[model samples]
Target: GAALRTLTEATTPALARRVAALVQEAVRLRPETAGQVAGCVDRRLEQGPTARPVLLPLVTGLLDGGPEQVRAALATVLAAAGTPASRPLRRELLESLLDRERDPAVLDAVLHAAAAQGDADMDRSGGGDMGRSGAGDPVEAPYRREDEIRGLVHRTGLLLVRTPEGATLLDRGLADLGRHVPGFAARMARWLTEAPDDWAGMVGPGARRTIENLAGVRVPA
Candidate 1:
């Protein structure tokens, strides 16, 4: 812990700036529970769209690192944004990572992000992104909240239902070119090469068949 002390500080205006962006991955150096993980990713999502560029780079690293890391990272992102940004961001982030992503783990997260959104929208199993309110509020994690859960779930769920304006960007953003991730062209090949039907296989048995049907994979029967 002593070693991480200096690194975690992120003090000073200069260090604080990139510190938020830079320290994201260090937390992923190991496994963290969904809540702990959420705080890590949400900090950036709580930032601004300007942070999108930085967030994308962090995704690239997580994607390149390993499957588990990528999954947790994506989960943190979804839990943090929940409805405020999860739905549309899901499509955009997936399109971004998938377009340039080659690693099965990374690609899986992109697809899984869609799945998380699907699960959250339907309020399945009474699980979804936890409350956006500060953690430790007792009513956090959506599941624990009895009074407001239904309303919160409905509002957040609606966003995921919409196709969003940018879902099709992958088809047209021909210029997004995923130059950020490693093995760019080959990664694009891996994603494009696969049948969209396969994506359904990645996230099967959810709220809407849209995910199962439109995704580049086949959903379980």
Candidate 2:
């Protein structure tokens, strides 16, 4: 618990990453301690966005080879930290892992992580049915600041839709939100409606196609 606390409490990004590396090393050298390490990592992740950069390398590095328990724990951390605010970081980590991660359990965790952020947004908007009266109005939900919307669009263009696998995951993740959160699709549409022209310029053609084809997302024209 001390080590976990230290890992999470590290104030700087470099410190956090260093602590994660040490935990990875510990997990490597002592398989029996995987649970403790994972627990610590999970706790740090639950602390929210600040832990993401620290947790990113730990999740990606450990995914390739580790005790099953260790990998599963890392996957859980990844899913929790996988928010759009983390954006390209989360997408980058997941894309790399999905390409090579062969463990079914680990892969399942990756997919689950991908949807975590979108689900969070859905919940914040209230998880009512889409056709439900309160569901479709963006005014009813918490507003996303311009910077947040920019980050989301940036990820959509630069990372999530850059590859087939990422595009698929992005599409699926949002769709899941729409299904579970109701009116989430409309809310997303409203959010994007305010994206500045520069945000559109940030997106590439492939990403535009993915957004159009899969989510029918409206972008600044």
- Using TM-score as the measure, which candidate wins? 2
Off by over 4 Å in 2: 8-21, 28-57, 80-84, 114-119, 128-221
lDDT of 1 at 12: 43
Highest lDDT against the true fold, candidate: 2
Clash pairs for candidate 1 = 196-215, 196-216, 196-217, 197-216, 197-217, 197-218, 198-216, 198-217, 199-216, 199-217
How good is model 2 by TM-score? 0.42
**Judged by lDDT against the true structure, how good is candidate 2?**
0.52
Residue range 85-171, candidate 2, lDDT tens digits: 454454555556556655544544554443354556556546543332444433322334323433543444344444556555455
In model 2, what is the error at residue 161, expressed in angstroms? 22
Question: What TM-score fits each model?
Answer: 0.37, 0.42
Candidates' lDDT values, in order?
Answer: 0.38, 0.52
Candidate 1: which stretches are off by over 4 Å?
A: 1-38, 47-72, 75-81, 85-93, 124-221
At residue 212, give the lDDT of candidate 2: 44
